[model samples]
Target: MRHLAIDVGTHRFIARLEEEAAPRTCAAFLEMLPFSNQAIHSRWSGEAVWVPLGDFQTGLDYENHTSHPSRGDVLLHPGGLSETEILFAYGSSRFASKVGQLAGNHFLTVVEGADKLMDMGRTVLWKGAQWIRFTDLGER
Candidate 1:
């Protein structure tokens, strides 16, 4: 199982790669490690935050996709009906956009620091966009 260190705003978390369930998406995502972007509270997807990539290509289709994601489930939207983006579910979430409902590749799942998910969501929701970074936690 591969792990990733996610630091968003002032909060930190650890997530496990869902390689078995979403191999292609996981592989592509891993190739882009040490990634940083701005995350804003979702206007359509409830209790979640997203980093809109806007046409960023992953060269892959949906794998292990879902519209409803539990808290701490991280999804990658492979750009089609809507723009490419990363969804971080902090609580109940039904992934969607201005265009309508959509599903995304469930590539990562937070394993540690989940207790702070709601706080992270609230912070982004009230305080506005926050900087989010993803780092590969190699060989551990």
Candidate 2:
């Protein structure tokens, strides 16, 4: 089984991929992969945006639920019901939101400690008959 983990934030996107074919080292894996240039807004006409996950500010305030916020930037996260869930929840939501539309492209996030979120971004893979897992980064 192959697994890709993404942690999304206001400034960047962090990604980690695990496959049976390659050895797993967080630093080594990140060093080899290039940043992905996938369009964030499909309908919007603009240059492609690249968001790496490790660039988030620790104490900055951002909103992740509202699409059109009246006063603040909306930050999306994958769903989790508890405080501990916040970490994976936010990352998962961002991955789910962007992955489908950005298919056939590559990208990265700027967050940290995102290796265990295998359930995130699983649905973004192409059609194939393999053991797949998906973390629905949706809030409902």
Candidate 3:
């Protein structure tokens, strides 16, 4: 299985890449390893933090997509109805954009630090945008 080490502000987490379910998305994402960006509380998606990737493209369409993701679910929005983005759900989430409801490719799922997701979300919500990074852990 493939794994990724995620750093959300002061918190850390390990997430499993859902390669089997989202092969193209995973491949495209892995190519962008060691990704870093600012994550802020989502204005449309509840209980989630997102890193906006304006006009970014994965060169792929949605795979294993979902608008409602459980806690710890990581989604990549294929730019179309809205700008591209990566969303991390710490609680209930209904993915959307200014246009309306949308779905994202569920490429990563947090396995470690699941309990801290809420705290991470809260920090981004109240303290403003937080620096987040995704480090490829390779397959293990």
Q: Which numbered prediction scores highest in lDDT against the true structure?
A: 1
Candidate 3: tens digits of C-alpha lDDT, residues 49-126: 999999987787879999999999999998888899999999999999889998999999999999999999999999
Q: Write the per-residue lDDT of candidate 2 for residues 1-140, one digit (tens) a residue.
A: 22333323212223323222223332233343432322132121121222323333222222223222111111222123211011122232222232222111111222333332222223222221122222222221
Compared with the true structure, model 1 gives a TM-score of 0.98
Off by over 4 Å in 3: none
Give the Cα-based TM-score of candidate 3 against the true structure.
0.98
Superposed by TM-score, candidate 2 places the C-alpha of residue 121 at a distance from the truth, in angstroms, of 12
- What's the lDDT for residue 64 in model 2? 23
Clashes of 2: 25
Q: State in Å the error of residue 49, model 1.
A: 0.2
Would you list the rank order by lDDT, best first? 1, 3, 2
lDDT of 1 by residue, 20-125 (tens): 9999998898899889999999999999999999988889898999999999999999999999999999999999999999999999999999999999999999
Error of 3 at 120 (Å): 0.2
How would you order the candidates by TM-score, starting with the best?
A: 1, 3, 2
Model 3: which residue pairs collide? Answer: none
| lDDT for predicted candidate 2 compared with the true structure | 0.24
